[model samples]
Target: MSEATGWPFWVMVVAFIAIGMGTSCMYLGAVATCAKNYGKGKHKGIMLAVPIAAFGLSGMWQSQLGTYVLYERKVDGSRGDVDVFRYFLFLGILLFVIGVIGTFALRIVDDEEEEYIDRTVEDLERSGLLEESEFFRPRHEIQAAYGTFNADAEEGSVTLSEEERQQRKRDLEREEEERRKKNWLLNYETRIFLQDPTMWWLAAGFFLVTGPGESFINNLGTVIPTLTPRSYAAAAPPAGLPSTHVTTIALTSTIARLLTGTLSDFFAPVETHLFPPIPEDRRRARLEAEQANRPTLSRMVFLLPSALILSCGYLLLSTPLPLIDPPLLHLTTALVGFGYGGAFSLTPIIISVVWGTENFATNWGIVAMMPALGAALWGVIYSTAYQRAVNSGSGFADGQCHGWSCYGLWAVTSTISVWIAVGVWLAAWRGWKKRGIVV
Candidate 1:
């Protein structure tokens, strides 16, 4: 297509990129808002999981709709006729409608902010559950309020001497005055988030897990039809195994998202809950002191299983034997789907956990691009390998590619790459553990 249009194809490319960016922004914005509203409450993982799960399930709905609605059967036994451009138009209109409706419906209530501040400290003292002095606020806010809350200090900065307290108040007022004149988007929280290494670690982990899954998703249509003998391809349904694989993936991925996110919340870090014997105020002080320096782990330990599951699936395809059978392909796709969902859902919640929710929208958006980077890299590998295989033999005819030999090496390489990604995440996990962090 690009060769035919030359420079003009760049217009289509740019438009597609713009569309992708727009959709991503909407998604991250919704997720961050939802996560922030629920982050301080119980079951935060499950609360944040629903939006991402919907994202996973949307692909299945789109696949089924496009298969039946966009393509018409020919008079002959084989299916041929398609109105792809019209189908895309329909999709665009549908998306626009959804976006409009969602914009109105997805409300993040701001009315409770004053109430939250008023009740938070009192409630913590009453219930003995508050972790830090500024557990609900951004770290920058905490710092600005009373300097660092040192555990061993004479009064830990919370009960500063009258003169010291007055100085701190003035400092906070000065900081607030400066903040009022600045853009909220480029605020201190965002600057702090950019400097954190844990964010990069999580994003890299996202890239590693999703890259091969994306490669599988993108190549499945080509892989499935071609894997079968040429005789079978002519008789297969227009929306046969490929569509089934994709839908199955989405379904499983959605399930994974819901289950994993909910489970993570149930397994909240011990530090978050109230411990007895110690006075409520003292416990709160200790909790705050601990939280001040450490990044919150978003129960990302839940994803270790997902990484292993995906690795197993990739291993199956990497084997020398042809995965020509539909049942086996469906099973593999389902596993991949689960991992895909887990990665997407968990990463956002993790970002919300580790990084303060003050700049979650921007932080999630920054990390979300890692999967795309992975996809682009793996896509190149799959494309090059498949093309080489096709060129080496008598080329494909009638939309049918012949043989498994083409994909075997690519599959193995992808499997190795995925395992390496798993290792990277494990390293991150170890680092967290070494720093006395819990996931």
Candidate 2:
């Protein structure tokens, strides 16, 4: 249910624009509010805005596409899932726009001769800077080279005498010393942990499991007993019932984002409240100790637990609920959808946790490409197989129409997904082993 899953092209165009406008407005409004109250640079304004923008894009597109799918399926009985073009297009547009906007936005406050002033920020007197800055606000690209804006040191426009410079040099070195000690865990905090090999294997396993769960889990409606000419066991969902298939994934992911968003917001405050008065260093140490209990590597832990929930949900959906029109089949797909959303939301960022940010797009793109391909190819293989076997009378479920065709399709798709996952994990593991990141 990404724009990548494609709905109607015309409808999607409209959805994209509307979502973009709404998302931009909401983001800008919040940023404006933050600037008015707490100020933007230090208020996490950029970080907060980007994700919200992402939500609008995905949410609107998914809704539009889902509606179109429902309409199409009802009109012609097809789920008409499209390629991953929307994902790529939206992503490219997002990054390009952000990068461009950032470039220009920065130019609005541009300064060229300020190199002299800028130099005061990064250097400690020990590192041979001319003097310590009286203004302790940060100056270098606001965010630690890894993030967005950081407060710039605004050195008052004043010249210093030789004696003032020397004394300030001493002061700067002392300031640098205290700064380092104050946030000793800054590096560790900014960086994600990836010490264990087993965790990567777990991540790959999750990826493998999701391949099937994503593409064909809700698909049983179009499949399974559909193997028979019109197996009446599960009444064909009323005309437009199957249409939900179009937006099911998108809707599911949207819900997951909402849930994750709520939890993430809640936890931040809770953590801050619990350690309201703890010394910064001690709090850092304590947090590290807690995370040690559940290795950051095991972030896949969420996926593992969710996967089982999804499987059960899918199973239930497979069993028709008497009152439900499409049966629980469509609704239960939510479990799988949530898991996929969680994985989709987390995986790329998680990969960067170990691989570093040097080429994050390349690293994540490759991971994403494989699954996208797997889902797509597996889908066509499944669709075509069932069609052929049903026609030949040797397809699926003991030749009860074409059951085996679906099995054959799963067999091949699963095999391919497993191989892709294994290859990625092994390569990552070997790289880490040789690099000796563990030490």
Candidate 3:
């Protein structure tokens, strides 16, 4: 397709559409699968983070390949044009092999396996060996304290009659049925999730925060040239400068994802009551007591710093210092990359924690769509600014404007957008707090 000059624009559009669809499906499927398999464990955050961090790191290697291996060399020893045909062929074969391997390797834990694991956990909890473990809550204590089990019975010696055992079995079956129902499309839980104001606020925050980062990435090549000295404006950008920034962003983004995922696991509050059998009046008190004792942080706390870091990047780009020495632009990308990567990684974990892994794909899909809108909005703003600068009679060469004026407006606009996102996230945080949701 890269070498087919006869192909129509519509054909190219269809090819792009196909690529986009496949990429989205594969990315979301991998994330949802990880969440389903590991979401109940203590390391759920890091488990989810691994695939997300991999997604960020992918850009680094791919860009490096395109720069160092897939490009033509000029007589002067500088890199020339890219070999788009070979690059496309390489990507196609690489993705095909990965897909083939994934088909055999990506198996979810089966129902029997999950049940056995649950039983083992219950046995350990009952044995009192896990009493000191923060991740496990003793089932026997919960049953006795909630009056589901006989309080008079001895701790490790409680027995159930045949009728009581049958009733307990029926209760478990009913709970399982309800859980399946909640996972169904357009169910009660889905309706509640859609109707919740907090969900929209969270989505809006993601849109505002991620859109600027997306735009910055898409425009990086163009923006870098703008920061070049007028004498060098007509010359090719410092060889590999843009690629270096791309790698920097990718690396920092990957690191941010890993760090945030691990930190969230360590600090975020754990849900104590998976299936609360108590009366509604007493449940709030129980939750309060559990939370007070645990004193875990909310996942929402991570978003504030992420947004601020992103805003700082935008603010830096809007300044004149980067034009004086364009290499200094690395700091901007690093900040934006860290903030962007952390926010993106945290979104899925938050959804899995608050809504649950069962409906995670649908919930995350809804939220994920917001970034495209944000990217388009910022992209347009950025293009308009660049075009205006190009036509400003500023002695810019090759239709490219030099200095801060070229990108300053878009950067300022993005900074404002990120701050607005911070406010939106705070609103979502308050909403979750009001409803006693940990995330």
lDDT of 1 at 73: 66
Which is superior by lDDT, 1 or 3?
A: 3
Tell me the deviation in Å of residue 209 in model 3.
Answer: 0.5
Give model 3's TM-score versus the native structure.
0.79
Ranking by lDDT: 3, 1, 2
User: Candidate 1's error at 425, in angstroms?
Assistant: 1.6
- Regions more than 4 Å wrong, model 2: 1-203, 217-240, 261-298, 313-326, 394-439
Per-model root-mean-square deviation over C-alphas: 10.4, 12.9, 11.0
lDDT of 2 by residue, 390-425 (tens): 777764454444334444555455545544554555
Error of 2 at 39 (Å): 20
Q: Model 3 off-target regions past 4 Å?
A: 1-5, 75-78, 112-186, 233-240, 272-295
How many angstroms is residue 342 displaced in model 3 relative to the true structure, after the best TM-score fit? 1.0
Could you give candidate 1's per-residue lDDT for residues 233-279 as a string of tens digits? 44473324676788998999999999989878776563332111234
TM-score head-to-head 1 vs 3, winner: 3
Q: Which one wins on lDDT? A: 3
The sequence of per-residue lDDT tens digits that candidate 3 reaches over residues 136-226 is 3355543434354433332433477758755765576456544443333225336657888888988888999999999999998888887
Instruction: Give me the displacement of residue 232 in model 2, in angstroms.
Output: 8.5
What lDDT does model 1 reach?
0.69
